[model samples]
Target: MTKDANAATQEKLGGILEARDWSRMHEAWHEDVVDHDPAPDQAPGLAGIVDFWKEFTTAFPDVTLEADPLVVTDDFITAVFTIHGTHTGPFQGHEPTGREFTVRGIQVSKFVDGKIAERWGSTDQKGIEEQLQLGTSDAQFVSKD
Candidate 1:
């Protein structure tokens, strides 16, 4: 892909991520976008992507994604980005934590014919873990064992 094409694709992802418009987000991805979670069962697909965003939205209804520069190879494209959000709802079986946080992450994507076909990513889990404990005595489990 040309530089312009790569840039356009990057911008598109930024837009979709920021908008959280899952209805049309799939169109931006390659038909076979891979979800590369630690568990294979959770790795890859349009449905998986949508599910992820749904959960993410629940965790952060007013979230926004900042797309980093895009790197393109003969077939794969990688983009580094950050997802920032305010935790105002329930997540991970936890009640409304009301914690605001921003997570930095990267997405390694494979594109076929200018469309994203696959992707693997890891977000700023450490930052999120810290944010989840911002206030309150929610941590009641104290086991010395």
Candidate 2:
């Protein structure tokens, strides 16, 4: 991918995430895309991405996602982002404390035919736990295998 194409893809993804437009976002990914950081209940492929967002939005109804600069290369794009929201619903079996949390994360995506074919992500989970006043986060979103 050229630099311009990479920027376009990054912007499109950020727009979709900010709008929470699941349907359109689905079109941005390949059918067999893998989310390395999927939620516990999320299935494989696009369905898993949908489910992951569902769980997140359910917990933070007014969540805001902001994407930072995108580091682009020929075959991959790395996005640094932050999510801010109030905990008003269940999260990892913990009751809501009505507290707000700001979590930062990085997602690196590999492109295939101009669509995201695979992704690996890491988030500030400890920050979330502290903000929520939880001893530890038991959210089993990622695979152990």
Candidate 3:
């Protein structure tokens, strides 16, 4: 792809997350897309991807997913991003604490035919739990990459 096409793909990817539009996000993926780092209890494919996002955004309606500066390759994009939001609903079996959290992460998306074919990511789950006053500070997240 040309630089222009890469830029447009990045723009569209970022826009889908920022907009939190489930349908558009699902449509951006290939029919057999694979998410290598889905949330607990999430299955595979576009159905699982959309379901995961729907539940997450439902709990954190005002969440912001900002794509930090990224590196784009011929068929992949690696991004560092921050997810910030307030706890106003149930999350991970916990009731709302009215607290806010900010977690940073990195994701690598591999594309095929201009659609996301696979994804792998890691996030600051410990920090998120701390912010929400859930698990102890010593909590850890097993590597998902």
TM-score of each: 0.75, 0.85, 0.86
lDDT by residue for model 3 over 26-130, one digit each (tens)? 446776788887777777888877776777777777888777777887788888888888988886577888899998888887877777789888889888888
As a whole number from 0 to 100, the lDDT of residue 57 in candidate 3 is: 71
lDDT of each: 0.62, 0.74, 0.73
Candidates ranked, most accurate by lDDT first? 2, 3, 1
Off by over 4 Å in 1: 1-3, 38-44, 134-145
Candidate 3 at 38: error in angstroms? 1.6
Worst 10 residues of 1 by lDDT: 136-145
TM-score preference between candidates 2 and 3, better one? 3
44 Cα displacement, candidate 1 (Å): 4.3
* Top candidate, metric TM-score: 3
**Greater-lDDT candidate between 1 and 3:** 3
Model 1: residue 85 alpha-carbon error in angstroms: 1.2
Candidate 1 lDDT for residue 91? 58
Q: Which ten residues in a row have the lowest lDDT in candidate 2?
A: 136-145
Model 2 misplacement above 4 A: 138-145
